[model samples]
Target chain A: MAAKYELKLGAATREAFGKALVELGKENENVVVCDADLSKSTFTHLFGKEFPERFFSCGIAEANMVSIGAGLASSGKIAFVASFSAFVLNKGFEQLRVNVAYSGIPLKVVGTHSGISIGEDGPSQMSVEDLSLACSLAGFTVISPADEPSMFALVKQAAYHPGPVFIRAGRVKVPVIYGPDQKFVIGKGIQLTEGTDITLISTGLMVAECLRAAEMLEAEGLSVRVIDLHTVKPLDRELIGKAAAETGCIVVAEEHLVDSGLGVRVAQVVAETSPCVMEFHGVNDTYAESGLPEEVLVKYKMTGADVAVTARRAYGRKK
Target chain B: MTRTSDLSELQSIARTVRRDIIEMIGTAKSGHPGGSLSAVEILVTLYFDVMKHDPANPTWALRDRFILSKGHAAPVLYSVLAETGYTPKDQLNTLRRIGSIYQGHPDRRFIPALEASTGSLGVGLSLGLGMAEAARLDKSPSRTYVVLGDGEIQEGQIWEAAMYGGFHKVDNIVAILDNNRLQLDGWVKDIMGIEPLAEKWTAFGWHVIEVDGHDIVALQAAFAEAEATKGKPSILIAHTVKGKGVSFMENNPKYHGVAPTKEEVELALKEIG
Candidate 1:
C-alpha cells in the first residue's frame, strides 16, 4: 500500500484551464475567451488580463455567452466560454444544444465548480447534473481532466478539436499525478496501474483518489487496475471492454451523480461487450449541504476508502 | 447595394414574394401566415436591395448574414431564399412536408443558405451577435441582420443578447424588430406590455430607428442608416400590421399560425396582384 509515485501539490483544474488559455492565446491568435460575469471566479480573468482584446465579459448572460461562443466558432475563431457549472449547463443548456451541439461548432464550454466540491456554495451552485446534460447532446466531446497536467493538455486539444467540447472542472486543488511531459488524446483512458482482479475507473479529482485506493488494495494482496477515464462521453469503450473481460468486474468513481455520469457510460460499454458486475461510487441520488470539500466527500461517501469499498463489493459479486 | 431606383422593381419583387408566401403556407395547411406576410418588406429589402450577398456563393466570407430570429415566419424567409436562388422556387410547395428540405422552421441542415438554424425564439440575436463579433475579429466587412418578433423579445434571453451587443458595440449587427403588434395569443401589448420599446433599445446601447415595416423605400433607407451609424448596434423597430397585405388577415392575431384556406389563398393572391 506504500506510495508508488511521489504526488505533488497541484492547482485546481480551473486554474490550469486559465493558464492554458493564456498559453494558447499566445500561440494562436484565434483563441478567444468569453465569460458570463464570472471571469474572476472561473479564472478566465487571467486570459483577459493577458489578452484584453481577445476576451469578452458577456455580463451575467450564460445563454448569450454560449451562442456567442458558437458564433465565434462558426466564423473562424475558437471561442472558449466559462461559467459556474450550474449556470452554464443548466441555464444555457438549450443554447448549448441548438447553437453549439446541433450546429456542430467547436466551442469550448468550461464549467468550473462542478459537483459538491465548491464548499459552502450549497446545492444551487453545485453542478451535479452537468455531465448528464452535456452527454445527452449528440456529437459533444465531454472530458473531465484528472489533474492540472491533463487539464492543460486537454484545453489545448479542445481548441483544435472540430466539434463541441464540454469540460468539467473542479474547485478543490488535489494531488498531481502526471508530469509536465505527459501527453493525452481525446476519448482515451490512461491506465495508471495494471492488474487483473478488478478495474477501478475514475475521472476528474476521483482519479487521484483511485490511485490511493489502488495502493490500499494492492497491499491487501488484491490485483487492482486503475484507469483515468477523463473522457466520459466518447469513453474509451475498447479499454473498458477489455477491463470487463479481463477483470470480470469493474468499479466506477466520479464526483458527479451516479445515475448518468461515468458509471452509466461504463455500464453501457460492459453490457455491450463483456457483461460483468459493477459498483458505482458517487453522490447517491441526493443533494449535499454546504460544507468543506473533505467533509462533503466524507458525508457523500466519495473518498478513496469509499472507492476501495465499492471495488471490494464488485470483487465479491464477481462469479 | 443594388438599390433599384425603379421602386416598382422592388415593389414587384415584394408582391411576388408575398404571393409565394401565401401559396406556400396554403399548400402546407399548417404554418404561420400573418407573421410571414408582415415581414415581407423587411426580408425583401434585405435580400434584394440592402444586404450584400452572392447567391452563387452563399458562404462567401464577406457576405452579409441574415438570421430569421422570428422563426415561425419561415414562409417569408423561404420565399426570399427561393427568390434569391438559394433554394429552387419549385421547392416552395414542400413547406413542412416530410422528406422535403423545407421544414416549418429555417434549419441550416436542410437549407445551406440559412445563416443560422432558429426556431426557438430569442436565441438568434445572440447568434447574430456572435457572428458580428467574429466578423470584427476577422476584419471581414460583413454585417449580420437579425429579425426578431415582438413577443419573442419577452423571452429574457433577448435582453441578455441586447445588453452584450450594446455593451460590446457590435456595430456589424443590426436587429430588426418585426413590431407587428400581434402574437399567437393576442396583441403583444395585451399579453405582455413592451411599451417604450425604442427607449429600451437606446438604453441597451443601441441606435434605435423607427420605420414602417411595409414600406420598401423606408426599410432600405433605415438599413442604409444602420450600416452608416457606427460605434453601436442598430435596431429598426419596424412598425407593421399582422397579416399585412391581405384584407381578411391584416392585424388579425387569429391568422398568426393558421394557414390560409384555398379560397382565401386565391383571394389573397388576387389582392396582391
Candidate 2:
C-alpha cells in the first residue's frame, strides 16, 4: 500500500471553485456572483469574465455585500458572495448571521484562502475559525470539500441548497484524489476505506491526509476505515453512527483547530448518542506561523502519518 | 385636531399600535418603547397606505420588501404586523420570551414579512440595495425599503453601503433614516452626531429629501417622490423627535430604551387620545 496511485486530482480550492462557477453560470442565468473586491484573489474573476452583468464587485465592503445578498435572495435568485475567508466571515459575520441565516436566504458565501495555508500572507488573511462561525448559525450549511471533483460537486449542490451556506477553501495546491466522475452528496460521507479496527473521520483538506495515513497504516497491518465528510454542518450522522458501531473507535481530524471543527461535530454525535473511543487530530488552540502548507501541517502534526499514529491510539482505546 | 375618518382611522390604528407596544412590552417585561412609539406613524403609513403587503400571504415573492434596520424598534413593526393579521394578536405577549418567534430582534425565520433579520445597525441599506439590484436584474417591479436609525448610520458599514448604492445606481432602493437623534446612552449629538445629514446623503449621490417625519402628508409626498425619481437611489431623512406624541417621553433621551411602567402606559395612551 505504498502511496497507491498517487491520487492525481490537482487544483487549489479557489481554482476549483472558479472553474465550477464558470460551469454553473453557463447553465443558470439566475446564479449571480458578488464580491467585496478581492475578485482576482477569490477567483471570482472567472465568473466576472463570463457573466459581467451577473457578477457584482462591491469593493472591500463585506457587510454591504452580505446584506445585498440577502436582498437578492428574497427575489428568488441564487446569490453567491465571494471574499477572503477572514474578512467575509469575521468582519461581516453579524450581517451573515442575521440577514442570510436568520432570513433563510439562498446565499452562498465562498471563503477563499481558508486556514493558515495562505502562507506568508500573515494571520490577518487566515480564517482558521470560519468553520466554527459558520456552524454556529442554525440553518447555515458549512461545506469544506476536498479536491477538485468534490469542490465542483459541492458548489453545484450549494446552488440548489435552500438557505445560506459557507464554503471554505484553501489557497494551497494539493494532489487531486478523486476521479472526475465521483459524485459528492451533502450530509453524506464517502467511505474511502473500510476497516474493523478504527474509523478515521476527516474532511476538507484533511481528507487527502487521512487517505495517505490509511495507506501508510495498512503497511503496518492496520486496516483503518476512512470517511470523507464533505459537509460539516448537517453532518452525516447515520454514517458516523454506523462507523462508530462497527469500528468501536474513531479518530477525528481537520485542518481547523480542535474546537468547533468537524472533530467537535463528530465527537458530539458519538458522545451524546453513540458511545465510542475518539481521538481528535487538529491544531490545538494556537496561532499558526508563516510556513509552507506541508511544513506548517507537519509542524502541527496533521499529516497522514500523524493521523495514522492517532488512529492506532484510538484503536487501542476500543473494547 | 380636525381630521377625516381615513386620517382618524390611521391615527386610531397608530394609537392601537402604541397601546399594543406598551401592553406587549409590559407583558414581556422588557422592550424598547421610545423608538417604537416614534416609528408608529411611519409604520402605519407603510402598512396601511403605502407598502403592498398582504398579511395573509406573507411569502409573496413579488411583494415589496421592508427591513426594520433599527430592529430595537421591533415593537412597532410587530404590533402593526399582528393587528394586520400577520400573526395572532395574542402572540404579541410572547415578545422576547423563550421559544417565541417575536424575539428582541425581528428574526425573519419567525416573521415572514420581515425581509431581513436585523438588529445590527447599518446593514438594512445594503440588503435593500442588493434586493434593488436583483430586481433590476430580474426586471421585477417590487421595491425594497429599509428603515435606518440616525444613530445607526455612524457605523462605518452603513457608509460603505451608502457609497455602494450611490456607485451602483441602485434606483429602486429607498433608505429611510429615523432621525430621532437619541441612541442607547444619550442624545446622539452628545454621543456622536450625524448633522448636515441631507448634504451628506446628497454628496453620496442619493436623491435626498428631508421631511417632517410626523407629518403624514409630508411622509406621503417624500415616499411618492422617491418612487418617481430614477437612476439614483433615494434617502428620506425624516427629522423626528426622540419620542413622538407621548409628552413625557418626547425629547427625553432616558426613554430611548425604557419599557413603560403601567402608570406610564396609561399616560401615553391618554396623550395619544
Candidate 3:
C-alpha cells in the first residue's frame, strides 16, 4: 500500500483541543468549558481567554469540576471539563460515574497529558488506566485521537453528540496523521494501510508508530495492515473483526497499560467475531521512569520498532 | 414571611409527606427512613411554596431546580414530587421494586423529572452550583436548591464545591443542610464531628442561615433571604431530628436505613396525623 498523506510535524492534541474549543465557543452560544486549575497545562486557557464568561475555573478540584460540568450540561449547556488524565478521570471517577455517566448528562470530559508520553512529570501524573476507567463507565463515548487534526474534528463531533464523552488527549507533539479535510465518525476506524499478512491496530500517539511500523515491515516485503483506532469505546468492532479475519494476525499498540488498554477490547472483538493470533504492546504492568517522552517510550518498549517486533512475532504465529 | 394559614397548610403537607415516607419505606422493606423523615418539611416547602417550579412542566427552563444531594432520602423527594404533581402518588409503593421509577437512590434516568441522579454524597452541591451558573449565564430567573445530609457533607467533595461556590460568589444556588445530626452508624458528632459548621460555611463565603429543619416558615424565610442575597451562595443549616414523627424512630440510628414494620408504619401514620 502506498502512503497518500504526507506526515508533518503538528502541535499536541491538547493544543489542538484548546484551539478547537475556542472555535466551538465562537460557533455555539451554549458551549461552555470547565477546568480544574490545569487550564494552562490542558490548553483550555485558550478557550478561557476567548470566552471568559463561558469558561469556569473550578480551582484544583477535579471532582467539583466534573459535577459542575454535569450541572451545566443538564441545564442546556455543552460543558467540557478539562484536567490531567490522572487527575480528572481518577480524582473525579465517582462523579463521572454518578453525575455524568449514570445521569446521562452530555458532559465532554477532556483528559489531557495521557499515558507515559507525559514524561518528566513521572508516573504520578501519567494516566495509564484512564481508557479502562472511562470505558468501564456505561454511556460514555471514549475517544483517543491520533493527532491534532483528528482531535479538532473529534472535539467538534463530541460536542455535537449528546452524551457523556471522554476524550483522551496527549501532551507531547507528534506527526500529523490526518489532513484538515479528513472526516471522522464517533465509532469508526481509519485504515491507513491495506494489507493481509498482519494488522497493526493502534490509538493515540501509537497510531503514528503503527504507521511507521507498517512502513518498516513494507521495506521487508511483508504486507501489513495499519488501523488507527481513535475511538476506544463503542469501538469499531467491524473494522477490527475484518482485519482479524483477513490478516489472521493482530498487534495492538497503545501508550497505556497492556492489561486493560485498547488491546483487551480489541482482543474481545477478535475473539467473538474472528479468532486471530494477537500480541499486545504497551506499558506492561509497570510504570515508566521520569525521562523525555521519546526516552520513556523506548525504555517501555512502546516505539515503532517495538510494535514492529510484536507484529512480526504475531505474524510468525499466524496459522 | 409565610402567612399563618400557609404555614399550617405546609405543616399538614409535611405530616402527609412523613406518613408517605414511613409507608413507602415500610412497603419497600428497605430504605433510609430517618433521613427521609428528616427532610420532609425542607423538600415539601421547596416543592410546594418556595421554588418557582411547575409540576406540569417539570423541565421548564425557567423553573427552579431541586437536587436531592442526600439521595437516600428519595422517599421524601418522591413523596413531595407526587404531592406537587410531578408524579403519581400510587408509585410511592414501588420505592425499591424491580423496574420502578424510584430507585434506592435518586436516578434521573428512571424519572426524567429528577434534575440530577444523585445517590453518592458530596456531589450534588456542585451539580446545583453548575445549574445556578447556567441560570446566571442565561440570565434566567431560576434558582437551584440542593438538600445536603450532615453525614453526606463529610465527603471532601462537598467542601470542594463549597470552596468554589463561596470563592466564586455563586448566588443563584441555595444549599440546605439537613442537620439531622445522625448518620447510619451513629450520631454525626460521635462518628465524625462537623462542629462549628455555621462558621465553616460563613468562612467559605456563603450567606449562612440556620433554621429548624422541621419549621416550614423558617425554611421559607431562609429561601427568600437566599434569593435576595447577592454575590454569594447561601446555606441554611437546618437543625432537625433524624426521625421527627415516629416515636421509636426519632433520632434512632437503627431507622437510618431500616424500614418500619407494618405495625410501626400504622403507629407512625397515626403519629404523623
Candidate 4:
C-alpha cells in the first residue's frame, strides 16, 4: 500500500477543540464557555484564560452546565459546555433534552475523552453510547470529527450554526487526515480516497484506521473508497447511498458500540437508499479493560487490521 | 414600595388570575390546579407590577426575564400572560388541547415570549443564572427571576445552580420558592423533607427573604430588597397554601394534578370573586 497523503501526528481532537474555542472567543465577543471542573482535561481552560468573564466554571455539575448553556444561548450568546462524554452526555441527558433540544436553543456541547480511547480510565469513564444518546435528541446536530484540522474547522462551523450541536472529541492524538486548506460543511461527508471495489465509512478516531484498512485492501489488488462521515445526526444519506451503489460493499467503523453507533445509521441509509452487503467494525457489545489505547483498540477489534478483516468479509459476500 | 391603592389593584389582578387558572384547568379536564392556584399572586406580582416588559415587544432584549421552573403550574403563567396582554384572553380556553399555543406545559416553541420551555423540575434556576450572567456580560440591568417549587428543589440540579449563583455573586437573579407545602403524592416533608430551608440557602451564600406568597405588598418589598442587595443572589421563601382560594381544594393533594369539575369551577370562581 502506497500512502497518498502525508500523514503527520497532530494534537488530540480535544486540544484542537481548545485552540478552536480560543479562536472563536477572539473572533466573536458573544462566545461564552461553560466547563464542569474538567476544564484542564477538556482544554476549555484555554478559552477561559483568554476570556475570563465569558468563561463559566460550573464546578463538577454537568447537568447545571448544560441548562446554563441553554440559558446563555436563549439570551443571545454563542454558548458552549464541555466535559467527559460519559459525564456530560449521561449525567446531563435530561437537561440536554428539556432545556436545549426541546427549548430549541443553539447551545454547543463538546464531549471530550469520548469512546474507549481515554485509556486507563476504565469503562466507567468511557462513553460507548454517547453518539446514540446525542443523535436520539431532536434538533441536535451531532458531529464526530476524525482529526485536529477537521475538528478545528467543524467546531467553528458549529458555532455559526443556528441550532443545538453536539460534538464528540477524543483524548488521544490521531493522524492528520485533512490539511488546513480543506473546507468542511455540516451534514456532508468528506471522501478521502476514490475506489470501486468497496467503501470504508467511519467517523471520529476510526476514520484514520479506515484509511489504513483501505491501504491494506488496495495492496491486495482491491480498490477501496474512504469517507469521513463527521455529522452523524443529519446523516449524509446521499453520499452514503452513492458509496453503497458504487462500491457494492460497505464497512462502517467507529470506536463505539456496534449495536447503536454510526454503523446502525449507515445500515439504515443502505437499507432505504441502496441495499448492499455490509459489515460493522466496533466494540461488539462489550466494554474494554484498562490498557494502552492501541492495546485496548486491538483487543476490542477496532484497529485497521481488524477493519480490514471485516471489510474483506463484506467484500467476499458482495456479488 | 407598593401603595395601598396599587396593592388593591394587584390583589384584584391576583383574584382574576386565580379564577382564570381554575377555569382553564376545569375546561382542559386534566391539568395541575393546586400548584397553579398556589402561584397566582407570585406571577401576578411579577407580570403586573414588578417586571419591566412590553407585551407587544415580547422579545425585547432589555426586558426582565421570568422562568417557571415548577412548570406544571403553566395555567397560572398563561393566565398571567393573558392578564398582562402577552396573549389573547380568549386563547386561554384552548389550553392542553392539540394545535393550541397554550400547551399543557410551558413550551416556548408555541409561544416565543417564554424565556424557556420548562416542565421538568430543577433546571430553571440554572437557566436563570445563565441569563443573569449574560446580562452581566452585556452590562444590561435586565434582571432574571425564577420560581421554584418546594418539592422541585429535591432535584440535585437546583442545588448545583444554587451553589453557582451564590458563589459567583449573581446579584441580578432572584429565585422564589412557592412553599405551597404540598406535592402530587402527598406532603413534601412526608415524601422527602427539605427543612431548615432558609439556613440551607444562607449556607449556599444567598440572601434569604421569607414572605407571604399571597401578599402583594410584601412580595413587592422583597423583590425590591433583592434588587438593592449587592454581591449575592436572593431567594424568597414564600409561604402559600396549595390551593388558596377554594375551600375544598385548599391543602388538598388530590387537586395537585386533577382538574376541578365544571360545577366545582363555578363554585371556585365564586369563591375567588
Question: Candidate 4: lDDT of A130?
Answer: 95
User: Across residues A205-260, which tens digit of lDDT does each residue of candidate 3 receive?
Assistant: 99988888888888899998999999999989999999999999999999999999
Binned by DockQ into CAPRI classes (incorrect, acceptable, medium, high), candidate 4 is high
| Tens-digit lDDT track of model 4 for A1-319 | 3268556788999999999999999999999999999999999999999999999999999999999889999999999999999999999999999999999999999999999988888899999999999999999999999999999999999999999999999999998989768999999998899999999999999998888888888989999999999999899999999999999999999999998989999999999999999999888788888889888888888888899999999999995
DockQ for each model? 0.79, 0.75, 0.92, 0.91
Best by lDDT: 4
Estimate, for each residue in B15-126, the C-alpha lDDT of model 4 and write its tens digit.
8888889989999999999999888888888887889888889989999999999999999999988877778889999999999989999999998899989999999999
Candidate fnat values, all: 0.71, 0.91, 0.97, 0.91
The reply for model 1, stretches above 4 Å from the true place, is A1-3, B1-5
Q: Which residue ranges in model 3 land beyond 4 Å of their true spot?
A: A2-6, B1-5
Model 4, DockQ value? 0.91
Predict model 2's lDDT versus the native.
0.84
In the range B215-272, model 2's lDDT, one tens digit per residue, is 7778878889999999899999888887788889898877777777888877777877
lDDT of 2 by residue, A8-93 (tens): 65888788898889889999999999998798888889999999999888988888888888777777788899899899999889
What's model 2's lDDT at A281?
A: 91
Q: After superposition, how far is residue B173 of candidate 4 from its true place, in Å?
A: 0.6
lDDT of 3: 0.91
